[model samples]
Target: MPLPELSISDWQDAMAREKWTSADLVEGFLAQIAALDSAGPCLRSVIEINPDAMQIAEALDQERQAGAVRGPLHGIPVIIKDSIDTADRMLTTAGSLALVGNHASQDATCVRRLREAGAVILAKSNMSEWGYMRSTRPCSGWSSRGGQTRNPHVLDRSPLGSSSGSAAATAANLCVASVGAEVDGSIVRPASANGIVGMKPTVGLISRYGIIGVAEPQDTAGPMARCVEDIATMMNALVGADPKDPTTSRCNARPMVNYRKMLRPDALAGARLGVARECFSGHEGTKGVIETAIRALRDLGADIVDPVQASELPFFGPMELELFQYGVRANINRYLSTHPGAQVRDFDELIEFNNRHAADVMPYFGQEFFELAREKGHWDDERCLHIQSELRRLARDDGIDKALEKHRLDAIIAPTEGSPAFAIDTVVGDHILPFGCSTPPAVAGYPHISVPAGFVNDLPVGLSFFGAADEDAKLIGYAFAFEQAVQARRAPRFLATKS
Candidate 1:
């Protein structure tokens, strides 16, 4: 039987009408993963499938039959990046072999929330080892535990990382939606490259309590799905203040609006959108696609601010790298220390473990970035503190804020990435074009979303919509409008290679 291209609401309606049970949904997805992920294309997107998923689905179905739906996400299947912790049988290794046997003592705040909302924890997706902070020339989805995750659109093309598997799986419809974490481009880039909807919510909006850390200041987990409505559906379950993560305290004070309700088809009618033209200077094919998308936005009533050059701001890249180094050393250690029974206790121990197991762990690339981070001082060191302050000021106040304030814009639009999926080259490493606009909003701790824009040579490209901190609702509205107007997303053909 051919399953429909079901959204969250569609799945809910199906269940409500007795067309499918939660167990049926889980089994269907599992079969797809076996056929598409494991044997057919060998996408290698999933690291570990939850052994208890079907049982959980059966229980959820029983509950639903008894007149109790947990919430909007009741019995929804969700794939989460491996970096996020779950207390279940799955290992939270972040794609590293060093932590192969490591298990979390309890569920990460995000997982707990998802479970409470009745989202079935389908599986853990592969990722760049340690969120791509291990080596300078790291391959996006090449992990020791789970090998390269191939893009479903073109089997040999790269699936952008560190959220590579999440994006790939979602685009392939292995699950209804997937959760991904991003420090810079992990979520958006992969979603853009794989042709899906990826949201990197404001850093504090989603709790980072159980997620493997890259940089606390910039790291966040959000939804990757086929449509903006599905992304919003996941966001509705993801948002809320968590006592475990202090950063979410501010979320409580803010107005709690249904993100799904904010999706207005006419949202772009009077909205001012700034085009980050500096980011538009990449592959001509990608540029042409994004240019067409921009024109479509204009045709749909958006007030387009063309050629906005916020990418020219100084001190953004250097400061961000410095902060990441410090964050890797400090934040990772903090997570390791809090979680007991871990094979490695600190970053230095991790380095030693990698060296000891170099044959399996460091087969292709060395941990040069980890070594560099190890040499960095504490997060509170005078130099580190100074860099953090300057990064926020430059990226937020002088960068995105300057552009937004000057144009009185509601959001900024750019190519989510410079180009479509590049060929995977293990020897020379990822040749992906460097046309990312994630740095500014990432450093600013703001929200950003990537919606499928169009195709470049049969490969997917994404259009980015970003906004000021805590303006997640507004950005969602704008992205929804654009997504509905453009209707650019196409189902993946699972080609053997780029045609």
Candidate 2:
């Protein structure tokens, strides 16, 4: 069998058994992309396919034949969000038309690691324009260049933003796995909606070099896959230090551990899990599913701490917005000036370009956020620094850290998102619901993982496991145990819409 119905281990076993080569696996996925992504469902998940994917895969197959396997991800096909730089033929536009001609001179640090592990960079997945930092009321997955990426589970529903394509493609089996970035709900929300596993590792666990940034404080790229085991395997490949990103220095200080070895089916036993009840407010169906998930955890020997005030601190949204505005103005300008292949050089020029081509770029919504970024003051302004420091303190020391310490918990659990994928509405923008758990871990720069918990009327809801900084391995173990117990994930049928 090809990779369409196989996990990473299964595919490796198949290849070892000589059932198929890496080249054959790539061809199977390319066929699936053509059949489902471009024609059948027209999910628009992949923005662009790497033309040299087959050649890369064939070379990896040759390596395997010569007894030169690199790692667990050897010959595995992977897709990365368009925001990541590949230093290849594909454009890194972050789903915006303004940077349509831009290309990277070198791979993102994470991409380099994946390549070193012998993974094929199969495609660049579509994302929210500028990772949803373009407009105030922008549609989640709508991009001028790649168009809107619809939910694989339900075609008319939203796939969430930024990491939308990564999750959607993974759920639809377009690739073995995909990498997605998250400043907030981008990774997990889409994964929840698409019924896959998405992980947002502690910021600095993976290098951010060559990725288009929103805010350095919250931005991090992570693995999204059909199983938590695959995510752990990818984590082993992705975690590393890079001099280009100073935040990554923290990772170098810590001793490395094999994440895949951390996965245990009985990891949940004797673990104390706290539930942030705040996230249980929205969507009665989702709440019911989370309740069932909690029961399952209990049955599996976990001590559940009901109603933990982990996210009691507020004002993070506004504070983060201020930081994003400052960071975007600084980060994008720095990126454009340094990247020789960039079409637009600065935020002002990008705005001018968008205005000039509004019919194409802003047909659905205006670039208010872009305009806001351009108008922000210098990055080192006292007010900006104050907000930045206060945000970290509140979100870290007073928020997640406090909760973990007070309850003596291994990790906090909650619904990954407020509800299932909302309607894909460009005219009215995204119907963002309330009571999400992404912000706490996002702002804390802590590790968070979303595992498919259960379904709500056929729409998938995820159980989020998040905790203190550098607790990624523990959270993954917990998530893996929960995943094995619940077995909530299933391949999407590409239903036209909800009746």
Candidate 3:
């Protein structure tokens, strides 16, 4: 039997009506992974499957029969990015071979929350090795251990990263939903390219304790799903404070939000949404799609503020890269210090490991970023501190804030990416286009979401909605409204390549 394109709510209803059990869903998805991921289109989205998934689902099924349901995600199967430590039979390698023998002593805070809320850890999705902190020129989805993840829409097209597998798997329905981490465009870009709903919530909204990362300040894991409602549901479970991660201290003071309640179809009515026109560069097809999206917003009773003063938004490319290098050295070393079982326990050892095993790990690209990070000074160094302060001031205050304040806008909207998926080019590395809106939200540590806008030459494009920090629920409401109005997303056809 073929699986329907069911949302989380649909699956809940089906289980409640006795149409299917959690085990049945798990078996079906496993079969699909075997057929589609490994055989049919060979998307390579999943790095590894959880051996205990079916058994866990069976246990959940037993609980359901006994009149016990954990919560909204009771028995839901969720694929998490490889970087998230699960302390299961699965290895938390971050799509790198150096940590192949490593295992987490305990679950990552997010994974622990998901499990406690009755979400089955389905699989570990592949990602860019070391979260793309290993190389300046690297393929977005081509990890040393997991190979390349292909776009389901057009096989040869890029899936975008470092959350490529999570987005691709969610779009291809390999799992009910997936969690992906991002410092920059990792989550939203892949979500946009795969034509799914992805939200990079306020950095502290989701704890970063157990997840691997390149940067501490900006790194966060968020939900990617077929619809905004599903994203909202996942957020409710994922958001919480962890003592190990000091960044989530802000969440402790606020009561937990019922994100699903924020999902009103008419949420866009009378909302002042500013268009970041400067981020609408590159492909005309993508611009055209976003244009139609803008009109749809207007039709839905949104007050469109076009050409917001975003051209003045500072681009912190060089400084951000420098900070990432410094952070990779600091954060990765800290993580490794805890995971003593790993072969390469420090940044210096990791660099040496790659040099010793260059044929497999460095076949496509060298670890210049790793080398750079190793040579960088401490995070508290004068230059690093200056970089952090400037990033926040420019990206947060002078950037997104300037536009919203100037236009009296509720949120800012733009093309999530400059173009649709480009052809996957391993030799020359990722051809990521300019004019993406991910940088501001990423650096500001604010909330940002991407909803499928429409197709550009049969490949998907996404519209982004972002604003001030801690306004995640509001942004979700806007994206949900837009999503319900246009309903632009369609399932990928699994074409070998764009015609």
Candidate 4:
């Protein structure tokens, strides 16, 4: 069997049954990567294969030999996004050539947790250069360091990003599980594209101390997996408070651990679920699939409500999409400064770097947003504060909260993205319908999970489950039930012919 067809659970059970060793699994994935990466439809998802990956796997095998198991991820191979910091041999470039040979002095909070869980950091996956904020060129998995990552389903289609490679690789089964960060649609969009499960935990649920930041308010790390249970398995090991990130102090104040034990497939049997009508006016296929899901929820004994309204939305209108870019330029530059060997240390330096490498980096689009972010003022500025505040209130306090209150709902359901993979193009930016990752839980800093909804044209579509801030458990429970009920996940063929 191909390495790309195995799931996290598949590998875990194999290792426990002694059917396969950790070393064997790592070697299988690496061999599969070499066979399919540059040729065989060429889904160039991996940016850098960790030099010490096998060594780490050997150590995990030794521990297993000693009957010293860490957990479900005891010897699992995992992939990290380029934006994540890892104090290892792999470069943390955030997919930017500017940081081509950089190294992190420390691990990002989630990476540290993965290590503590005994998971091997398999490789650095490709990304939208600088988490897709480098330009508006619809880079989708294309990075100056690693070139474009094709959708495994259809070689010519786009694997929607920022976290494009992470989601694509997981769907292609390049790793057992993957960690991707979200500002807006980075995690969910690609998850939708790849027919997999993606969990964007509440912004502070998983610490962000060492992640390359985009928007502090919206930035978060999440688990990308083949199933909701796999997501839970990974998150159980990753979620916690880190003193390095003050945002995690909230979790420290509570001190809870092991979320998987709390999961129940029948958990949604008595929960309140809302349908956010405001988010789906134009997406007919998405609307149909979600309605089908709502019917299944009702069969599962859930109380469903329609037309839940979102309140106090931003006055910026469509300009709402660009708000996070300003946040990314400000925060990513600060983090890059701390990474030695990175070519660009600041936004000014990035623009200068792009200017110098225009032939390679700007072969498609200019750094328009980076220039605009350089012009924006401090966080306290009235303009920045007012819009960001409104974004949160609408997504959170007034919107999701209001719906939950009025309908007594426990969670909400919507489409994670407009549809499956579209044609990849550097000339045009994302062709997303206005209905995706727009409201629901994104702006609210709440928990949202996306799993395979269905397909349009052999391309995967995803359904999103959203709930209140800190309602991560319930949302996961609901998603797990839905995934079991629907069973829609399909492996990419990587066929000799494109769809």
**Which one wins on lDDT?**
3
How does model 2 score by TM-score? 0.98
Candidate 2 lDDT? 0.89
Provide the lDDT at 3 for model 2: 52
Candidate 3 positional error at 379, Å: 1.2
Candidate that beats the other on lDDT, 1 or 4, i.e. the better one: 1
Ranking by TM-score: 3, 2, 1, 4
Ranking by lDDT: 3, 2, 1, 4
| Ranking 1 against 3 by TM-score, winner | 3
lDDT of 2 by residue, 1-499 (tens): 3355678888888888888889998999999999889998999999999999999999999999999989888899999999999989999999988898898989999999999999999999988989888888888888999999989888999999689999999999999999999888889888898999999999998999999888888899999999999999999999999999999999879999799877999999999999999776658888889999999999999999997988754322677888888988887887898786777888898899999999999998999988888878988889888878988888888889899999999999999888877889999988877677888888889999999998876788899999988999999999999999889999898889895
* Pairs of residues at least 3 apart in sequence or in different chains that clash in candidate 4: none
Provide the overall lDDT of each model, using Cα atoms, as 2-decimal numbers: 0.88, 0.89, 0.91, 0.79
lDDT of 3 by residue, 370-463 (tens): 8888888998999999999988888878888888888899999999998889999899998877677888889989899999999987799999
Clashes of each: 0, 0, 0, 0
Q: How well does model 4 score by local distance difference test?
A: 0.79
lDDT of 1 by residue, 338-450 (tens): 77667898889999999999999988888998989988998889998898888788778888999999889889999888778889877778886656688788888889999
Candidate 1: which stretches are off by over 4 Å?
313-316
| Candidate 3 Cα misplacement greater than 4 A, ranges | 311-316
